[model samples]
Target chain A: MTGPRLTPLAASLPDTVPFVGPETQERAMGRPFRARLGANESRFGPSPRAIAAMAAAAGEAWMYGDPEVHDLRAAIAAHHGVTAAHVVVGEGIDGLLGVLVRLVAGSGDRVVTSLGAYPTFNFHVAGFGAELHRVPYRDDREDTDALVQKAREVGAKLVYFANPDNPMGTWHEAGVVEEMVAALPEGALLVLDEAYADLAPAGAVPRIAADDPRVIRMRTFSKGYGLAGLRVGYAIGAPALIRAFDKVRNHFGMGRVAQAGALAALADQGWLRDVQGKVAAARDRIAGIAAANGLRALPSATNFVTVDCGRDGDFARAVLRECIARGLFIRMPGVAPLDRCIRISAGTPADLDVLEEVLPQALRAAAG
Target chain B: MTGPRLTPLAASLPDTVPFVGPETQERAMGRPFRARLGANESRFGPSPRAIAAMAAAAGEAWMYGDPEVHDLRAAIAAHHGVTAAHVVVGEGIDGLLGVLVRLVAGSGDRVVTSLGAYPTFNFHVAGFGAELHRVPYRDDREDTDALVQKAREVGAKLVYFANPDNPMGTWHEAGVVEEMVAALPEGALLVLDEAYADLAPAGAVPRIAADDPRVIRMRTFSKGYGLAGLRVGYAIGAPALIRAFDKVRNHFGMGRVAQAGALAALADQGWLRDVQGKVAAARDRIAGIAAANGLRALPSATNFVTVDCGRDGDFARAVLRECIARGLFIRMPGVAPLDRCIRISAGTPADLDVLEEVLPQALRAAAG
Candidate 1:
């Protein structure tokens, strides 16, 4: 017997699994990871103040948080040197991306992103039935000129680019980003994701004035701020675009402890710097380990290091499987050229020690 | 210049405010509430075990939560004596409602709810461009007969009912709800909201079969579990209906600490029993206060008590305003007949004392 009818688009789509959590894999494999370095999480953890704040606020989870998120928004405004009107906080950058996609791109509305850039963003576009124009990355960096040209060719309304990009962890400097922003077609808007901007070098993230209507920048507490699990993120843009969020956003969605934890995380800059330092060191250690295993490590400005296996995608995938088999949880790019490299997040040295020890064996197994 | 265009439906709808959170009123009043007896938050707080679990999880806030919510779902399944596939967790009941509406009702699709029922659910329906056919409440309870007739008339795909009703703090027995479920139209689905079910008396919430395709029950950790601010809610439904969420849900939306806390909270039945007892005691105190003020308090199976103001919506509104002005922060329903009462949440004895002291003066002021 027939049950319920899904929307035409939804009916056509398969009930595919989007992502499998580490726990699921561990359960399948009958073992836990020796090094949890996949998914680009900041294993360095959040600031002590943030942790303290969360622990203290833990008892107050009974009450619903303020829907407007005033204090957090105000703090974000102060940090970004913008008015509170310019910011809209959400569950995470992932959540904001979904809302932005729904707002700007409707059924078959053209949206542009680099091929295999951010799967989460692509997932949202697909959810709303947006037609995608996926440009290939040039030399592991998003090809700015190509993306702009495609956006204009298709009259795409929303363009997504992440500076200090994920999976590969490469970045573009402010000047190049500003140049691309200027090239945006009239009526089109750029969604510049700076989720990893804090870990990048100075001038790596564009210092756009928050009032700019042509673009919006997305940031998150997930990566450098070290509160990924708290699910807090904000976007900075013209008030017009920012206010549009209220029209569609889940008003009471933000977690109360998460809000308090994020505010404290933002206030403690010293802890962020300390985490950043640890991440940088971890990246170097990963690179060294890769080199010792006769692989090339991509230069990264973000928290994870992408190691090139000096081989094809199949070989790299085998390497990934071997590593996972050995209980070193890591991941790789899904597309060609980039797929020849496996991505590993920065972890504590002890965690990295497992990675270093396991990689050599995994490489040998892959070659065999 | 115009920003991104809202859909034609969104453009036509008025810019409405669904809720005025207590924080908003406190900001307006320039002081904190002495008795935070509004919004029906559990003043009993979460279980001590949940608090400890959350506090311990404070350090791991940097990692993205398990998108699958595997552990929590397993625990919920075990507790309910059902398979994990029967449960789907979300931001809150509001979020689950949004997903359900999206799955079934598109533009102009007929959906039914009680007039002045959960505004958040209505907000979601409007957001999705559904045609809402609202049946008025029957004697302070959602009218099951009227709702069934309207659904048949409209050929509605979805019908929403909240048992142990909000604002009025009223409920019907499980047998009546089961009858309502059986009487629903073929191919139509019912959203049975049991947000306050735990506090409800025996026979208040029906035991629908786990695989009942036509019925989906909504529950939350917000009321009895005392974690509204943490934003954890779930739905129990047939796997076919539940799996639809995977197509569009923000997979990693739930916070890790929140997941852990909710799991721990659900495990501590003793704490929940203690809270239930406290809530029952507080309800008695609230009724007594209403009686002293010459107002009849409606019988409540929920955390809040509704004091009948002995007139239409207007007089109760006046009482609500006075309470707000005096920093009491109590709320009343926004619509007719039901607004004939002011809603006050269960709070501590100290909090109740403040309510007891201030409410009479507010009632006197409103009488003028």
Candidate 2:
């Protein structure tokens, strides 16, 4: 290659997409999807106030956003009962996760995450050339005991967990999670991903003290707030951990409109509650439909419902393809055992109607 | 620390602000700048069509951006006469620089740049634990010969230069830069930042083949296209260099609204030309104003004009402070002898009127 040689790591890694976005898949399939349920997006849409705020800021797209993210951080701090120093907002939780991993992990350092958890987190670890230890979920929930054991055994510097997790909407109670936090080794830091916390029931979110430094929690406006396309997410942690981001972060990364849209989304609690209600209703509709099709829907504390296919991974995959063929965009776990199920995100009533209509035909075709 | 332990490289790094944003300073002073010219943002905002497109996208803020950035990359490639594989869209030049540095420069690797060149590039170098070699500019233009020599002397893996550079609106002719590229060490990559290329004079932007594997050129909508706050910048290079970004980039980092805005902006070449004309006239206005203030503005091929302060760094510092105190958000170079100049951006006639009205007062106060 006449181009500059990539550092050994970049040269070695393959060009891979973490998830095939529905848009790309639709393009490949030469059509649009009927029911948009994959990617865990809130089809209920963003807060009306956020949309209005974004429209208002559209013309002022010439000035850079506040690099400190001052206003948004202040609101988030007040909401969480923490100081603004405890928060760091970025492009999204994915962006913040990349920064956090860069802050701590280097080549050869060990980082732990549950296998088949959030691939984006693992992607960040691999991007930094860190070694990742994957502990398989126990009975669909991330095995917290296994995670702590591996962290201690490997002397990992960071361990990642998500409450009310993705692909499989399974979670442990707050007490059990607190026990896992207690078991983390002295040198190990926990990344508690609460991306779906808003959709999860009360008490599903562990109420850690605002000043706790052992764990850094990531939350996003993308999920329950329905602002995924706006690209806003934040991390809350010890002030020191938050400040370390300044050393390497893209200082002007956030778009001005996004910051404004997210602030509006955060402030409009009524709209958020309205979306949460819709999401809950959609989740029930999906579970009910899944049950009617002879599959068991996993109890969910998140926006998405995971339905056990009552068959194997191959059957589940065939079912997924059938759904896609019928214009439904749904997904399943990438790994074994967990792949025996399909994950469907909460959506509008019309989107669910499309899913309900397509499910029977897709299942019959898969069976055929 | 109870939080994550930073890696040795990250720990050694300092919490440094590469450039204090004009916004931060404005908040500190509890006032807004009357003439906002410091950040090189086009006071002439993006096209009305681009704004309309982003506004239309406001409702779709619930969906994540296409991870492949397929449409935006295709549009950029078409605009630049290259294949889709030749370009990668990112948050901005700053974000792209962070990725490129990570892809090529590892711990203790050598990278070269002009001493007072783009500070964000240097920040990335330090963030990655790379050894930075600074070559002082020859007469305010990045000394091409000295940069190549430094690269060879230190076996540097990366060398950076910005055409129509910032902090000092000085530029090297295309032929001179082409010669510099020809003289680069075999293994070193050239990062040609053309962020201001569209605003430059004739023959300033080189006609290098997009497939040239030895160099990667960066361009942004933030300048001539007047979309700075939108945070869209792209790198055009050989397929190899572009593909390397896929390995570590936040695949979904780019915002959906930004992608929409940039696509519309690129398609509306007429709007671009109109803005370019406005930029030229403003540059002239800024120059004439500087001349009336007893300071000679350097010939600029950029939106910003660097006025020679006719004294030492301290005098330029005083001039800058006086301008800021008088509500002009102008900036100056960080290192001598370029520090003997203060940089002012091209703005609308009304914006220039403010500068014209304030310059004499600022000068008088600085002298006292």
Candidate 3:
């Protein structure tokens, strides 16, 4: 009649998830948000061709997706001017991070990242019972020098750095990133999370060799490609390193419709350019709204704008709560300093209109 | 620079996958499969309602699926006569099994299952660095008593038993399963994989209390519900046991289309009943096909039939190769005794016509 005993590591872990999705908040409020500007999801939908592919693939839902994910991998490799051996696709960047962590870091292994970086990465590190040493964000951007120093000091197995970073949307140029790759401690692999790569300005992405063993870069269809719901993300690294994923990954985890949609989406680079323009325009609108509210919007190279609330974490928290109460779903960074800002995603015109109407009132309510 | 160092446990693992998907075989063969009966996917297809839902959801792919998966969980709970807390949905049964193994069994922990029961389960156990103790199948079925005895002997943390089992397609009634649950050693958990439950005979699925902590039962939409490509599977168990999944799982791994399609599929039980009838009829047709070829089909309560090749593993392997060479995608069990058989999934009448034509030819080729 007793339950099975969880492993010591599992028992020691908490039940807290990495992020509380907006759907969760909507359920709690018993109503949907007027603007879905959280989680950095694209308000601009995926390519019409991708939608058609997914719709067509839906009827073929009885067949398991190819375990090797052949066509998509080949397509992605060709797009990047690399071979299939250098890329491995998974459920998403989150899923790949979990697997990569498992493959490299055993219990008590050292891992490094920015303190207020992606909580999902931290979650994976802790889940695998690895010790995570986090350096602070230096001036609103991930401090590459500090991260490398920390990795060398700890002899860390992995270092996670998201370029054109989430929450802040600040980015280092290609040369800066290339230097970061060069600075990786011996035997310490850098996990370059370029989830927002498609939305980044030209030259923001580095020209690392596809066979670079010191780093594995992850890119997602979730951001600019606008298919977060499909859960397709991929990693590119040395063939040997990429091959190791097969040893631990759920071989047939990818969905058939997801593969089809992603392939079609990748093919429609024109649709991607359209999304990029729209996201850029939306970013400016968000900045304009922030300026009108007497708040400063950080210069962003990604799909979201981080509005400095010009106060403490508590004030930002209050503003976030107020926005949520006013039927706007928004989020703020969890740690201090970074927590002084509230993050917003690119939204449709109507959605942004709702934000425009709500922000002033929300700020007034929070000021009280 | 050198690549990242892998954990000793990960480095010790091999690159061998659980199953070679038909697509991989097709690629090697330089063609498509005429009859894809290897993976046990429902060629009968998903509910029309589910396809429609998935198609509609495809356009909404910009949004990440609800991380909490509230509605689908509620629907699955309602279908199973349990509360939402008692059910936890995941990417697939394979994905869930990996998480479950990580939750309960750590490095060097003992787990028990039939030798050839399910390779994917064994893969997860190995991937997690758990030591697996396998008992042999008895008379082409998983030996429940032997499994229980071994679990007790090893003080195993987990014991996996697939009812209406895969590959062999033999099953035990509910009372036998209840007895197995009662016989679980102290602190040992039973992973009851009822992936084929929807196609099983009445009373084959044991009714255990929702609060039973010693056993967690998994069911999938991939088989009878005919949505393998959608990748939705669920486990029912005590709330605490189910909650542990949140500690380590990829929180937002399930796709939006998958959730929507599964919800619609659950609502259309009539479609499921129709599938059940079709599967039963197909099973009979397969048995007839095997008789015509002078082979023996194992009695099955599953969507697939395992036909004993009437000779050694070499003969079955040869027959499998012949079928594959003829563009008939099928599989054989990996372990001996069971390896003396080739497994075939329920396919469309058109697909079965190809199987009927190919099986005899394959048999002749193997004989030569």
Give me the candidate number with maximum TM-score: 3
DockQ of each: 0.67, 0.77, 0.83
Model 1 chain A poorest ten-residue lDDT run:
A9-18
Model 1 collision count: 1
State, as a TM-score between 0 and 1, how close model 2 is to the true structure.
0.98
**Sort by TM-score, top down from the best:** 3, 2, 1
Candidate 1 residue-wise lDDT, B1-368, digit = tens: 36655445555544444787788777877888887888888999999999999999998887778888999999999988889899999998877887778777877788999998888888888877789999999988889989898999998888989999987889988898888888998877888889999899977978899998878999899999999989999999898878888888888999899999999999999999999999999999999999999999999999999899999888888898888788787888878978899999999999999899889999899988
A248-348 in candidate 3: lDDT tens per residue? 99898998988999999999999999999999999999999999999999989999999999999999999999999999998989998899999999988
Q: How many angstroms is residue A330 displaced in model 2 relative to the true structure, after the best TM-score fit? A: 0.9
**How does model 1 score by TM-score?**
0.98
lDDT (Cα, tens digit) per residue for candidate 2, span A179-217: 888888888989999999988877788877657667999
C-alpha positional error of residue A91 in candidate 1 after TM-score superposition, expressed in Å: 0.6
For residues A17-136, what per-residue lDDT tens digits would candidate 1 score against the true structure?
566778778989988888888888889889999999999889999989889898999999999999999999998998999888877787868989998798889888888778999999
Alpha carbon lDDT of each predicted model: 0.88, 0.89, 0.93
lDDT of 3: 0.93
Worst 10 residues of 3 chain A by lDDT: A1-10
